[model samples]
Target: MRAYLATSIGVACTAVLVLPLSLPAGALAASPAAPPSGRDAGVRTGPGAHSAAAAVPGSTESVPLRPLGSTRAPGGIAEQGVAAREVRPFSLVGVVWDDADDELRGTVQVRTRAVGSHVWSDWLEVETHNQEHGADPGTQERDSGTVRGSTAPLWVGDSDGVELRVRAAEEEDETGPVRPLLPRGLRLELVDPGEEPEALPYPPSQNSPETRPGAESGTATGAESGTATGTPVSLGTGVSPASGTMTGELAGPAAMSAEDRASSAANEGLTELGAAEIPALTKAAVAAQQPDVAAKAYAAPRPRIITRKGWGANESLREKRFGYTSTVKAAFVHHSATGNNYTCKQSPSVLRGIYRYHVKSSGWRDIGYNFAVDKCGNIYEGRAGGVAKPVLGAHTLGFNTNTTGIAVLGSYGGTNPPAAATTAVAKLTAWKLGLHGRNPRAKVTLTSGGSGKYGKGARVSLNTISGHRDGFRTDCPGSRLYGKLGTVRTSAARYQGR
Candidate 1:
């Protein structure tokens, strides 16, 4: 049965009073003596030796404790218990003892080998008796006690010895009386091996198959020995067939199946483009167009992109750097709070300020958006370009992960966005939609519940563009600017068709 050393009140007392027990002859020396108050007893090791040095403070040595089988006391009461049957001679396992309360309780097991001999099959029994007078006139009152059953054998002795065999009472059984079985004061003996060899459980088997040797054995067969026949095979298990086995030859690209050839062609196409492809395309397109008079578009200097400093650089922005492939299910717009009272030329400074606040002070690595538009209608880049390539940005909670981030430069909450800025944003949107092969004027549905501010109504696809507050909890783009999302989309469509 599973048994562990229990530290109950009885166990505590047992640990306390068991001190001062005498050591067996040749047992290791007693530990440093304990004070009269029984405090500061250090750890003890030797058999039947009480060592204050070995005892922990406030702890006492426990008497040998054991569990007996379930049985009823002579009376009708059901009692379950165990007895310490025998202590082996010269055995390292120790004797039993009781505390000041006269309670017989505590675990007794083999101590470490350094201090005592390991003895197997050892035990100590305990019982209590009534004091009575016998016929002998000169004799004082005598004490006679009844016998309790033996404890299960605990293994002890050399490395091969049986360890302590402990058992516990079943749940249905009651613990027997401590009084009669264990007297207030009684010395327990330590037992050891005699002469007859201990009874072993089962003789070890010598015919196990694993111990055999040869090519046919369970062990691995090497290539030189050539025990295996057939082609070398690489099963996922790492087993390879013997050498001189035939494996199919590799197929050349020309010999590939139709599907494989098609896949290879696609991969080659992707590799043909270099890192500068997107930027070059953007520059060429802008150069071919006339600056919109309404937006007053002009070329802006490209800012030097900074990588996150220090160890933070290692974090990947692959998703942000490469645009992700997503259905342009909807579009969201917002105004940079810092640009509330600023003009288009001040956009760079605003961006720098945002970077300082988010990256330097707030510990973010980069500005978190896909693109930013200025009052002059110039579209400035934000976040790693790759994120815009195929992945959405984290601009708005919940919706940002799926929607593209487009920030306008000024506060539009109450006042309308600059006509130039609005017109520029429209032209930019048309260009982007064309690149994705979508018609800017396509009829689409806009759901208000996603952002929660708009009332329910069916709007055209051009009306799908929404302000940031439409999908997130924010006063983005100002109250005046946010309401014009539909108009911006319609204007962008008209410009693209023109």
Candidate 2:
């Protein structure tokens, strides 16, 4: 008999009411008390107490930025940010403004104090070109009244104190220097990925999926740690020798709401309903599953990937229905731009933080990328749709319709992405692109969905494996990581026997 982790049950039980995305100015007068501020602003520190609102899977605190007066320098610049103050414990931070069409043409920087420390870290800059990575124009996800402009999130680990500043970029003219106007409704977002979900009991069965509750929040080991063989062996379990087909008593549709059932049904054949992850398969096993003989020859082994449940994703946060594209034609690589100061142990927490920020603060339908890879080479499913399907993502602004987005978790502007990370990318694209018969080394034509770099409906030719910059005029995936695309393409092609 085997007991599976009731991750699906966790989703069914943790139902949170969706809140209104934005409020008019008059509503502020009737709102709840403002968040604490100033020197005496010590906030309670705990796992579930971090959210600015009531307990949700994770939490986001959106605080308004106040003006800091003129610099009185040669540039005639103005600044805005919060003074150093204590707040609820948070690990990731980003800035957001009211308008989705607005661009934050300025420099944004932040400094933080570790949860238990008095010292503060040096100011770090947050990338401001995040508009290039989002839902395409005219789509429901993009035109939803809730969408807003945002800066790339920065992971600062667990910090209890924070201070930040946003300065308008300066321009030189005949009369000294002039600064541009900052977008209105500027607010700082502090995100806290909530504690890992607890494992609940399931009826015993020989085929029950394994559970790793403790491993979800910290460094993974054994099966959850991922082995080179790509097969995970289940370890601990409490069981009784009982056997039969899966029943409603074992947590079936009877225990889940209509919405939860819809979400689980999307991944029907990928894993057991409510399973924490989709287990890995050997290359031969993967090829055997493909019906086409030619496709079988090119199919690469499916890599081990953690599911949304495995990472404690609060399923209730996203819109009920999962969205899909016609087919996956290209793969666009990106860097999370969430900084690089995290350990493999903290990857799930970081994911949860980004998830909350994407939906709660930036006002998107869900986490933008289709999948994510960690610095340690671990792969995790992104978005709520099936891993093997062509799930439409709000990643590359104009090319999201027919392409999949894979974001490596960390900044790579100057720092090089580890060899392990790039290898994982190659392995992922080999299996994913091979499914659609795409050749990694070949060029493909993708019509633009309207981006700063390309007009809507423009036929644009791009590599099958492309950097985020290929479709948009932005420094995404970063220079260091972007420079490795040629190597990634060649390696991915080799994996597919090209």
Candidate 3:
């Protein structure tokens, strides 16, 4: 479980860096305006940090970390060393180091090239605070475990040679002296994201009780649609078979501006058509009128969950087909770790970036989070398994199994998450957990898989609805979003009829 490459980087290691420069050639920026930051989780966006690599012809030589400039920092930069046969062909790369428990000790960047080509991609910065990147200790490398401190995985299409640099930290903005620590146990990892088949479309839609439009998608809930006479009637129990107690809130959901939720009141007399017949329900599906009949007494309304099929998810990109856990007892919320620079329409592409980063770069089987929510409140299916089942996620370290990870699609550290995003979390958990008959407001004890703050097999009690930080040491789900967990939990419980 340890890929510890004991390379001796002197306390005097130094490197030159140009500030405010665009990423090196072959470098890609998801958002140019955003600054750089890191944590120990999956969905991170590479913002302001520009990356670049060497343009030298491909060789068997390994480029070493050379001294660049010293900002009164302790390190004076030395030749960390070079490579001979250590360079091999691989698609994914990672940098690992020891921090002795302090925050981001240093910065690690890498560049790669095809086996025989001289062209090199721009340098990609590895996340230094990657302590929580691995699965729980004693599990699969791609699943979870301890790797001390590591860098975020970077993907270079095809390469045989590599160059890496771990420069000292720059000066602080307060114009004070910066004494950076020379990280120990620095090494580079070359990962081969196992090959897999391209995604295949699902078999033609069938009438298998699963409807794409109404109930499953969490449309408006209340008394059923009535006949043309306006007689109040019960609709087909707007609930998933697995969910019975989810009597959702009808106010905000009910008050949904004649959009988001399709009102059954207007379609009382309309014929019930299969999801294939109507991909996206028409505006008529939403209703604005008050419930004419007695309101159902359930706690939460089943959210209109968008299945993987609805968002055009490309299943083939993942290395693993589908794996399942026993049950989902806890729901951990997280932020994509990427910046808040994308629009709802661009969510799919944003997903693509994360998917590729997780699989090809991060070296995981699929996306880490089980589900993703956009700022606009659109929920996109994550992982390949059925949402109804407990899909093991690589989101929370030491707690990936038996837990579901729902990541909002933007970094929520400094910026506040939109209200739509928060409400979506409540709607989703209400039904999903309700399927498992979980009381959202209850507390559950789960054994730590290992290597986080908790010891392996340690029974730790956690809220049924919790944040990623609640289970691990990283500031995941961010400060702002984490601050609103109380509201999310309360909303979820209310939806669950708690």
TM-score of each: 0.34, 0.78, 0.55
lDDT of 1 by residue, 1-498 (tens): 011111111231011112232333335333224342221122222221232233221222223333344543333212222232222222212222233123222333332231233332222211111110011111110011111112111212222121232222223236744212332223222222222212211121111111111112212233211112222221111112231121222132675542233211211211111111111112122212323332213211111111121001111211111223243445567665432334333344444333322222112223455566666555554553231232334354334323456777544444567765665555555544433334444544543212223333323233346666655445665576666666677765544442
Report the lDDT of model 3 for residue 25. Answer: 32
Comparison by TM-score, 1 against 3, better one: 3
Worst-scoring 10-residue span by lDDT in model 1 = 133-142
Estimate the lDDT of model 3: 0.50
Clashing pairs in 2: none
| lDDT score at residue 452, model 3, on the 0-100 scale | 59
- Candidate 2, residue 44: Cα displacement in angstroms equals 24
Question: Each prediction's Cα RMSD?
Answer: 35.1, 13.1, 14.8
Question: Scored by CA lDDT, what does every candidate get?
Answer: 0.32, 0.69, 0.50
lDDT of 2 by residue, 1-498 (tens): 001111111121111112232322222223225653320131222211233332355566667897787663343336888766777778888899999788777788887767666566656767786479788988777876778899888788887777789998888878878776788789998887878656411111111112211112123344333343244432111111221111121123667654345444455545555666565544445555676676677666556667777667776566645667767789999998877777776788888888878877788878999899888877878987677777778889989987899999887766689887898888788778877778889999999989889999999999999999899987788788999999999888877767
- Looking at model 2, residue 269 earns an lDDT score of 49
lDDT tens digits, residue span 171-263, model 3: 565767565645555555554332321331123222121222223323422222212213322222222223111112122244443211221
Single out the weakest 10-residue window by summed lDDT for candidate 3: 273-282
